[model samples]
Target: MPPLSRPPRETRALFRNAGAALPTRHAALLERCVERRLRGPAQVLSGHHNTNHVLRLGLLPAVLVGAVPFARLKYRVPRETVEVVPRIWPREWDVLRVVCRFLPEVPRCLAVLGDNHSLHVYRGGTVLSDRGPHGRIGEGLMRQFAAFFARTAGIPAGELPPLPEDWPADGDSDGFLRRLVRFTEERVHRPHRPRFGTLFDAVGIPEDAMARFLRGLHPLTPRPFALLHTDVHRANVVVRRNRIAVIDWELALFGDPLHDLATHLVRMGYDKEEQARMTALWAEAMTRAGRAELTAALHDDLGAYLAFEYAQSVYPDVLRAALALPPHATADDFHAAAHRIGHALSRAREPLRLVDVPPEPHLIDALRHWHDAQNNPATPR
Candidate 1:
C-alpha cells in the first residue's frame, strides 16, 4: 500500500499552533534566511511542544524553530520585528549559541526569532541509539563522551557562564541521593496509595525494609565542578562516523562530572561485566588525559549513584501503570516496562553492593578484590 501524505492544511495548522504565527513578509524572510543558510528547499518535518517545528532542507536536515507565546489579546504581532528579537522562553538558545562558538561539532545557528524563539540548522547525525545494533560503536562512543567532558573541564569555571537560573542542579550526586531518599519514603515506603500501584509491592520489596535500605546509604561526596551534560543517556548521544556527538544541552549545568558518567551508565543498561569494562576504559582515558583523580572518584561513586538512579525510575513507572487503568495494551506495556526495570534493579543490586564501598585510600582496589573473591573461591581477598 502507498503511504499517506500529510495534508497541507494540517501541516499549516500544526505550524501555526506551534507558534510560528508568521506574517506573509516574515514568512518570506524566514524562507530567504533558510535558503541562504541551506542548499535546498525546506519542509516542515515534525512538531513538538506545540511550538517548535523541525524543518528539513536538503543536506542541512531539520532546523528547529522555537517560538514564544505572547500575552497580547487583540492585535496580531508583526513578524518582521520577530526575526531579530531574542527568544523569550527557556534560554537554551543562549547556551547553544555559546557552545557552538566554542565547539565546532555543535550545530550552527541560522537566526534568532523574538524573545524565546530562534532557529538552529540541524546536525545531520543519528542519535547514538539510532546507530545500528548496539555493540563496539556504543562502547567507543561512550569513551569519546568521557574525553569530550574531560576537555570541557579545562575551561575555567570563571570563564563559562553559570547554568541558566531555571535549570535544576539536582543531578549533582549529593542532591540526587537526597532526592532519592525522599522519593523512596513518599512513594515506596508509605501506604500503597501510589499514583500507580507500587512496583515495590509487585516486586515483593517489603515496605518496611525499603526505608532501612535507603537510610543506610550515605550521600556521595560532591566532586569538582565542570560543565556537565546533566542528561547523558543513550538517546541524548549521537554517533556519527564512529564518533560520539552529544546533544540536548537543555539540562546542561556546572556540577560534579561523575553524575553525567553515572547517568550514562544507568541509561545504557550496563550489566556488571559491561560496567566494569567501561569503567576501566574510562579510567584509562582519564588517566591519559591527566584527570585520574576525577576518574577515580567516578569509579567509587558509581554504585551509590546507580542505586539512587534505579529508585527514581521505580515510582514513576508504577505511578504511570496505575493511572492508565484497565487491562489494555498500553497498561500492559507500562507494567511490562516497570517489571523489566524492577528485575534489572534486582540483578544490579548484588554488584552495586560489591561496588558501593566508601571512597577512601585503596577503596576501589579493595572493592575489585571483594568482587573477584565472590566470583572465585580460590581468589583470596
Candidate 2:
C-alpha cells in the first residue's frame, strides 16, 4: 500500500465518513481545506512518523473553544516510510468515537478528508513535554493520571472497535506480550534480515534476540483488559486548567492494564521515585474503581511488562537511528547514531541477553558499511 503522504493510484476512499460529527462551520472549513485546497491558520508539526498540522482558529462563542482553553484543529499526515516497524494504528477517528462517548476531556473526530486524512479538534494547552514538571508531576497531577487510567480501563470492551481475529483472548496478558515479541521478530527483524543481518551481527544483536527474551519470560497473572493509549509519552499529554488531555490515538490498544501503565511509566521520562509513586497511584485508583483484580500481581508482573517494553523498543530505536542518517552522512552523524543505537543496546542488553557490546570504532565501521551498502547495492564492500 502507498504511504499516507501519497495519494493512491486508485480512488477508493480508505476512511470515508460524512462530517456529521463536526459543527457545521467546522465541517465547511474542513471541506474547503481538503477539497478546494484552501489552507487555514495552522501550525505544522514535523515528527518522525507523521507530520500534523494543528489548526489555530478564533475562539468564537459556540466555536470549538467553549470548554477548551482555545479553538484549534489538527490534520494528520503520516510520514513516508518503508514499513520497517509494525504499527497497531487504531483508526484514530474510530478510537476517538469510543473515547468521546465516555471522556469529554478527550479529542473528537471532526472529519476524514482525502485518503482519510484525519482532522480532529485539537486540545488547547501546553503539551507536558513543552512546559510542565519534568520528573514528578506533583500529587494533584498524579491523582489525575491515576483517575485517567482507571476511567480508561473502565471503558467496556463492547464499545471498542472490533479486534483482529488473532488478538489474544481478553486478559491473556502472557499471550499479548508474547505476541508483541513475535511481531517485532517476525514483522520487523525477519523481513529486514537480509538487508540488515550483517549490520545486526556487527552490533551484537543476535538473530534470536527476541526469541531468547520470550523464552526466558515467565507467564503473567491474568488481568482484566482495558483501552490503552500505548504511546502516552510527555508529548501526547496536554495540560489545561490543571487537567491533562491525552492526544494521538493512533497506537491505542485494548489489552492488559499493566502493560499500559508500564509503557507510560517508561516513556513519561519519570525518575525512579516518580515511577513508584505513579504505580501506587494506579493501584489505588484501580481499587477505587472496583477493579482490584487487574493489579493482583502488580509488583511481580509490572517488571515483566517493563522488560518487554525495553526489549521491543531496541529494534525500532536502532533501526530508526540508522535510517535517519543522511545519504552522505558525516562522522558526526555516525557518532550520533552510534550513541542512539548504543543506548538502545545498553537498555536491551539484559532483556535481550546481549553480550559483547560493540565498541565505538566497531560500531562506526559497521554503520559506514551498512550505509555504503544501502546507498550502493552493486558496490561490494
List the global CA lDDT of all models. 0.49, 0.75
* Model 2 Cα lDDT, one tens digit per residue, 1-381: 544333343321322231235456755664564433326445787655577887643323113222222345666777765443235543677778778777788877656655557666677788888875466678898788899999899898998888888888988998888877788888888887787788888888888898889877988998778888787788888999889988777777888899889988988878888999999999999999998998889999998888888887777777787888999999999999998788778878888888657888888888999999999998675
Which pairs clash (backbone N, Cα, C closer than 3 Å) in model 2? none
Candidate 1 per-residue C-alpha lDDT over 280-366 given as tens digits, one digit per residue, 9 for 90 to 100: 776677678777666655656777666655645444443433333333334344445445545544544442332332222232233
Residue 14, model 2: lDDT of: 26
Worst 10 residues of 2 by lDDT: 60-69
Each model's TM-score? 0.58, 0.84
Candidate 2 displacement at residue 314 in angstroms: 1.2
Off by over 4 Å in 2: 1-29, 35-42, 56-70, 81-90, 132-136
Worst 10 residues of 1 by lDDT: 69-78
Distance (Å) between predicted and true CA of 84, model 2? 8.5
Query: Model 1 segments beyond 4 Å from truth?
Result: 1-53, 57-90, 108-118, 132-139, 163-194, 197-214, 219-222, 319-341, 344-381
